[model samples]
Target: MEQLATFGAGCFWGVEALFAEQQGVTSTTVGYMGGHTPRVTYNDICQGDTGHAEVVQICFNDSVITYSQLLQLFWQNHNPTTPNQQGPDFGTQYRSVVFYHDQSQQQQAVEMRQTLNNMGLFKAPVITIIEAANQYHLAEDYHQQYLLKRGKASCSL
Candidate 1:
């Protein structure tokens, strides 16, 4: 099945860039997830009270990239040990999280987390949560394809 994976690993820009570069990632989007609100503005989420996380929704071809492979890439790209932060970005919105789409993913996330923890890969324990996806609010137009279009103005992180 063609599957989707949603993750919040700090700033969506860096997270989006990493997944977009992956071979099997057919499509990717910057968005907010794991929030109670149906649709929330980016500004609101930034304030840290929206209960939403800054996330990237990845659409990948399962034929080419297994979810486990994607998860591996995810672990390599971001710091899951830090709670509510990635690099300079901090707060609950930037919290490390994984929004599993189904039961298999839930199990995979748990297993992967255990493996990573057992390996002693990081100082802080992996705080990424695997929650059932609720709603995904696509980022504004200016935020879409941000790394591609704004390469000159901003660093790729």
Candidate 2:
């Protein structure tokens, strides 16, 4: 079966690219989530007042890759210790978050976070938020598959 997993780990560009190349990932859409505003734009998120995090919504085949594996990728790709920031981008839009689609997903996310924390994987504590998915507004077409369009393998970050 196909499942959904939404993650905000730094910029969506590289994040989306990473997952899109994965074995199980069927599709990926870059978007905004966990925000109050309706139909938020890239400019609005950049303004830093929309309460939205730039996110990538991934669709994957559960038989090929488990949600736990996706969580591991999310944790490994970016520093979850820093709040409201990633790499050179400093803002709420770049915050690390996991938007769970079901109770099972929620539980898995929480447990995985705790396990990583207990393992002391990071010098600072992991601060990635695990919450119910909010409205996901797709980013502008120009932002979708941006790295691919530019013939780049990853974001400069």
Candidate 3:
């Protein structure tokens, strides 16, 4: 069956590229989520006042790749200890967050984050937040597949 997973872990460009290359991911859309603003935009998000995070909504086949595996991918890709920042990007929109689509996704995200913390993988505690999926505002057309179109695998930052 097909499932949906939404994540905000730094720049959505790299995040979308990473998932788009995954075996089971069917599609990835860069967007804004977890915000109070309605009809948000890239410009609005860039201002860092929208309370939204730059996110990628992923569609994948569960039979090919489990949600847990996707969560692992998310954890390995970005630093969760830093709040409101990822590499060169710094703002509320760059915060690490997992927007769960349902209870199953919520449980898995919480457990994986806990497991990572217990393992003491990072010097600082993981601060990635897990929240229910909120209204998603699609980014401008140019933002979608930004890296892939440029023949890049991931962000240089």
Candidate 4:
């Protein structure tokens, strides 16, 4: 079955690159979500006034790759302890977030976060927001698969 999972783990470019390499991910789109404004552009997100976080909406085959697995990948790829930042990127747009597509996903994300917190993997508490998936405004064409287009494996630039 096909399922949707959206995550904000700092730069959408890196997030998109990470998940796109996964086995069951059919497609990945970089976008803005959880914002008050509508039809927000990349520039609007850069300004950090739109209340939007750069997110990557992934379409995957659940039968092949479970949502739980994806959640694990999310945790490993970015620093969830930071409130409004990831790596060198600092802003509301770079905050960690998990936009659950349904009740099942919400439960899984919450559980995983709790488990990770108990495990003491990080010095700080995990601050990854778990919320219902909402309005997703697709980023400009140039932003999609940015790293892939540039033949880069990660977001170094």
Every model's TM-score = 0.94, 0.98, 0.98, 0.98
Residue-level lDDT of model 2, residues 1-157, one tens digit each, is: 9999999998899999999999989999999999998879999999999999999999999999999999999999899999988989999999999999999999999999999899998998999999999889999999999999999999774
lDDT of 4 by residue, 12-40 (tens): 99899999999999999999999999779
State the C-alpha lDDT per candidate: 0.87, 0.94, 0.94, 0.94
User: Distance (Å) between predicted and true CA of 30, model 3?
Assistant: 0.5
Error of 4 at 18 (Å): 0.8
Error of 1 at 109 (Å): 0.6
Measured on C-alpha atoms, candidate 2 has an lDDT of 0.94
Deviation of model 1 at 148, angstroms: 0.6
State how far residue 73 of model 4 sits from its true place (Å). 0.3
Q: Candidate 4 has what TM-score?
A: 0.98
Clash pairs, model 4 backbone:
none
List where candidate 2 sits over 4 angstroms from the true fold. none
Itemize residue pairs with steric clashes in candidate 1: none
RMSD of each: 1.7, 0.7, 0.7, 0.8
**Model 3, span 90-119: residue lDDT tens:** 999999999999999999999999999999
